[model samples]
Target: MRFLLIVFMGGGLGSIARYLVNKWVGGTLTSVYPYGTFLVNIIGCFLIGFLIFFTQRAGASTIFWRLFLVTGFCGGFTTFSSFTFENVELIGNQQLLLFFVYATGSVVLGLLATYLGILAARNI
Candidate 1:
């Protein structure tokens, strides 16, 4: 029950943060691309990577923290559905080039961000 509560609260917090980020970035960006979702996913990926690395390095058990952060917070923060929808929309609109670029860039950049986070955590 306690674990569930923790996850619930963490998820709420993450969701709120995600919403604010989307509003801010989405409003600021001039491109038609889903920059908000892309940024959120990349940030979530990096954060999860950093959290795992830091916890491991500090000899911390990750069971509860993982559930709260990775399973809950990150789960709420990242939007795979939105990303997929955007890709489909682009494809449906016959923007094949943009669809390919957005999809590929998100995956590639997300991985790179995660790797960088891992490295950053390791160095700390």
Candidate 2:
């Protein structure tokens, strides 16, 4: 019950943060690109990687933090479904070039961000 509550709280916070980021990015960029989802996914990936490494290196029981931050928060924050849907829409609208760029860039950048996060955690 305690664990569930912790995850629930973290997820709620993450969802709210995601919503705010989407609103801000959408308002700033008037384009067909899914910048909001891309940003959140990459950020979430980095955060998960960082937290995982930091917690592991600390040599402590971080099950609660992992569940809250990684499983709950990051899970709520990242929008894989939206990303896929946007890609489909792009394809249906014949935006193949944009679709490919967005998809490829998100994947490549997300991986890079995760790696950077791991490095950052290790250094800290």
**lDDT minimum window of 10 residues, candidate 2:** 79-88
lDDT of 2: 0.82
Report lDDT (CA) for all predictions. 0.80, 0.82
lDDT of 1: 0.80
Error of 2 at 36 (Å): 0.4
Deviation in Å, model 1, residue 41 alpha carbon: 0.8
Per-structure clash totals for the candidates? 0, 0
Model 1, 1-124: lDDT tens per residue?
Answer: 9888878877888899899999999789978898987888888877776665676676656678877876678767875634665686799899999999999999999999999999999999
Candidate 2 total steric clashes: 0
Off by over 4 Å in 2: 79-124
Q: 1-124, model 2: which lDDT tens digit per residue?
A: 9989888888888899899999999999978989998898878767776766787886668888877886678767875634655687799899999999999999999999999999999999
lDDT score of residue 46 within candidate 1:
74
